[model samples]
Target: MDPLLAKIEYWILDCVENEYSYLWEIRSVIEQRLVDVDKAKLDEYLCMGLSSVLTQGYVQAFAGIDFRGEEQLVPGFSISTSFIEQHKKAWQAGVEVDQDIRFLISDTGFEHYRQGCPPEYFS
Candidate 1:
């Protein structure tokens, strides 16, 4: 794998796992510093980052995880609602989920973001 791709993957994994409080800002910085890269390649890598990684719904609230990136990272990246499939183990397991998801699963309206937008809004 390309080292730059690996580096992007690492940061993306971190964002997906725990989330970067300043995802868009840091990504902008990264993009600015990586001007030599092709835009298509960057987008491909960004999309790949999500497609290659498997995420748990209840455990991490993959669904409804709101990212406020208003095209700051990608040309048009804004998360209305990122939903993942429900996981039964999430309820039975003793581990605590992300605060955004731990108790919001049953909520009629997600505490953070519950927009009904499609996941491909960015794509």
Candidate 2:
């Protein structure tokens, strides 16, 4: 993995561990840690990293929670890898992700993270 991507992946895993899985919250922590990075560049890298994990089934995306704090349904659109890619493009074009999406590390993701994210995934 790229050094920045590696850091982002670890930070994301950490966030999931801490139960702070919302995109905004994860971004805030990463942005704070990478203060010297340009915002645009950071967003680009973040999108890429997120897309990769989601596509690989290492992370699951959820949306559309009801007022009762129950997960009504997983937003089918947001769960796709293409959605994440499009989101990254939109963000780069200055259009923000307007959905209320949250992420969770899948069991595979936890195993991968615990295994230090082996070099195969790095490629």
Candidate 3:
């Protein structure tokens, strides 16, 4: 994986692990960690990293979370290629996603992280 992508993935996974599932929270973590990287490049890399993980089924995106903190996952919500494309486009275009949308690491993602993010999965 590209170094920037790796860093993005690390921060993403970390945020999910820490219960910071909101997109803005994840972006904040990435921004704080990679302060040297300019905004445009950071947004680009963030879009790429997020799209890759979402398409790979490693991270699941939810439409919202209820008051009880349960995810309100719509059926087939994260399965469409267009969904990922739209997310990337919106992110790069500086359009804020719906505040309720959340990204959580799936079981496979947890396992992958446990295994230390093997290069094959990333590449």
> Tell me, what's the RMSD of every candidate?
16.7, 6.1, 5.8
Please give each candidate's TM-score: 0.33, 0.66, 0.68
**Per-residue lDDT of model 2, residues 1-123, tens digit only:** 577777777777766753427665666767787789897666665676666677776677766443236543353323344544565576559875445567777788888788885455323
Q: Give the per-residue lDDT digits (tens) of candidate 3, residues 1-123.
A: 676687678667767864537665666777787779897666666677777777766687776535156656544444334544476577779885444567788888777777776555333
Please list the C-alpha lDDT of all candidates, in the order they appear: 0.35, 0.64, 0.66
lDDT of 1 by residue, 22-87 (tens): 323323434664678785455455444433322212112222334443212322222221221222
The number of clashing residue pairs in each candidate reads: 3, 1, 0
Q: Rank the candidates by TM-score, best first.
A: 3, 2, 1
Off by over 4 Å in 1: 20-33, 55-61, 65-123
Q: Compute the lDDT of residue 84 as modeled in candidate 3.
A: 41
Instruction: For candidate 1, give the lDDT of residue 11.
Output: 45
> Model 2, stretches more than 4 Å misplaced?
18-20, 66-69, 72-99, 117-123
- State the weakest 10-residue window (summed lDDT) of model 3: 75-84
Q: What TM-score does candidate 3 reach?
A: 0.68
> Comparing candidate 2 with candidate 3, which one achieves the higher TM-score?
3
Candidate 3 has an lDDT of 0.66
